[model samples]
Target: MSDARRPNPSNEIMRRKWVRQLRDALLLPPALLYVIIEEIFWNGATALLRQIARTWPVRALQKQLMALPAPVILPLFLVPEILSHIGGFWAAYLVTRGEWAAAMVAGIVIKGSATLMVVWIYQSCERKLLSIRWFAVVHRQALRGRDWVLEKIRPGKELALRLLRRSRAGIIRRFAAIRQVLAARLGFRRRS
Candidate 1:
């Protein structure tokens, strides 16, 4: 005989309490979705987001959502944002007992060091931290832009010309003397 039990037709039933539990359970997973979307949007989805936005569920869903004014739906994002602060608070609670409060107070610390660790965990554990390689790429582009700006603001060529005028002969003399010394040291005599 098969070990698998036959379906219970009676189990098709669901109550208001069950529906409430289902909705509540969904709230937690929305946070997970929030985390995933944020990571992709910031890091990975720049190329694919347009295609995604054009697709059936996202396009249709966004259409419905856009019908509601921004104010009405803005609170949807607030859930995870508040949870982030609450996460910091809980992590602070973990570090501090009654007597430890003095340490936090004496330093006049706005938040304990644990807050930074908590925020980092919030970023990485949620897989929202941008890859370090991508960050370096972005930083390199920013540096290039900055260098371009400095080039635009650079001193006139006349100033550079002035700086080179006296130094040019000195530079040439130094190089020629070094070459002559090397020629002498290497026993290479000039033909008369």
Candidate 2:
């Protein structure tokens, strides 16, 4: 290739950097929202558990639950978590069917129910749950499956990045124009 037609290595690096930054900026809002929702759920669940634990009947039940073997108590602990996951999948199905209100209600109900179940499990049989061999095996297998799926999807992610890079300049210009229009409408003077 002629020197004039050659791609500059530094420019390639800069383009990659810009794309990564843009991707991060675009993703930040949703990631932050997820973190906020998770925090709210965790705190709310903990508070509810504390309130529940103060009841004499629940404390007595917890004492009885604590005496059970891991094999017996593990099923009780796992059942609620499995049901919550099923409810979430059902909500997703409802969303696909365009039942937005029903999906929202299902999501809320599942979360609330799951929170209570988890709190009860923790309060009642935390040690027994941890001691279950089959539970640990299942958890590890699920993690492995998640990692495998993510690995499989990585090539598609790279193809998307490549397409985005090819169109980067046009997208940047469109966004710049939008910024200028908004600045003008808001009576802000553009710096040269």
Candidate 3:
């Protein structure tokens, strides 16, 4: 058999192992950062949203939103997102004017509220919105992109989650101690 035609199972396996290690080396730090940010920020927002979703008015609004047709849903979805960008830009202008606290408040109030609205409406009317061909295509593309990122970061995500699980109890205990100390310092009595 020619050298080029010879089977090389061991070499092929080694090459794959090397490639995987290299990929992990390159992607692990960013993946860990992504995990931390998602846990800290997105989880909090999602928890708050879940609480809001249980309210009577929000439930009624969700029902009304779900009844919307694809055409109406498209504008409803896009408008909030556009307004959010405008709010973000206004926040940036405030920053440029040295209005630090105003910028922070605007960012949290306007952009944050708009984000909640967009997420709520999207969750409410997702099926109706996806009935539109273009919207469905875009949604599919976004999902594919998300899937690709998740796949690339799978190993890192697993490691981060494992470490987080191991550290969680310690973190909670430390936070509880700190909270107690702060409360005592602030003259707040513990409720036995």
Candidate 4:
């Protein structure tokens, strides 16, 4: 190759760095979203559902759901997931149309409902659904992806938690001040 045609090490290094930067920038939004969805919505909703599921009526319903066959259980497991995608698409469309408040409300309601249903059904019918080989494979892959994302975002998560912990007292004081101001404006004086 001629001198001009030869690859340059410095240029290659710079290009790689630029590519890395671009890749990280692109990945950050989705990674943060996954973290938020998993940590906030999924965990909280699932925990609440789990408590509800422990009630006698819910337990009876779950027992009936678990008795369902594998084929039936598959669709039951999938419908909520499909609804989730549709809801997400609708929410994105709302955002594109500049309906910010509506989009936020719709996204939360749709996503939260779908998440609760999916978690509830999955927890109830786990064994039956897992009996299907294809589902088991997909479930395993989904779990692996979750683990990978969590691992990738671990540093950011730690940093956020650390900052929140450090700011906890300040945040409480600010909230207290805001409450006092609001209460005074509303003519609700403190008895003490």
Worst 10 residues of 3 by lDDT: 33-42
List TM-score per model, in order: 0.23, 0.50, 0.58, 0.72
The candidate scoring highest on TM-score is: 4
Show where candidate 2 strays beyond 4 Å. 1-40, 137-192
Regions of candidate 4 where Cα sits further than 4 Å from its true position:
1-25, 169-192
Q: List the residue pairs that clash in candidate 2.
A: none
C-alpha lDDT of candidate 2 relative to the true structure: 0.72
Q: How do all the candidates rank in terms of TM-score, highest first?
A: 4, 3, 2, 1
Question: lDDT by residue for model 1 over 82-138, one digit each (tens)?
Answer: 554454454346447655655445322333222333333333222222234554475
Q: Which pairs of residues collide in model 1?
A: none
Model 2 agreement with the true structure over 1-192: per-residue lDDT tens digits: 999899999999999999987986776554444444445665767765775677789889888888888888877777877776676677768989999999988777986588578668756776677677777777678566545444554687589889999999999899889867866775553467
Number of the candidate with higher TM-score, 1 or 4:
4
Query: For candidate 4, which ten residues in a row score worst on lDDT?
Result: 182-191
lDDT of 2 at 179: 68
The most accurate candidate by lDDT is: 4
What's the true lDDT of residue 126 in model 2? 68
How far residue 41's Cα lies from its native spot in candidate 3, in Å, is 5.3
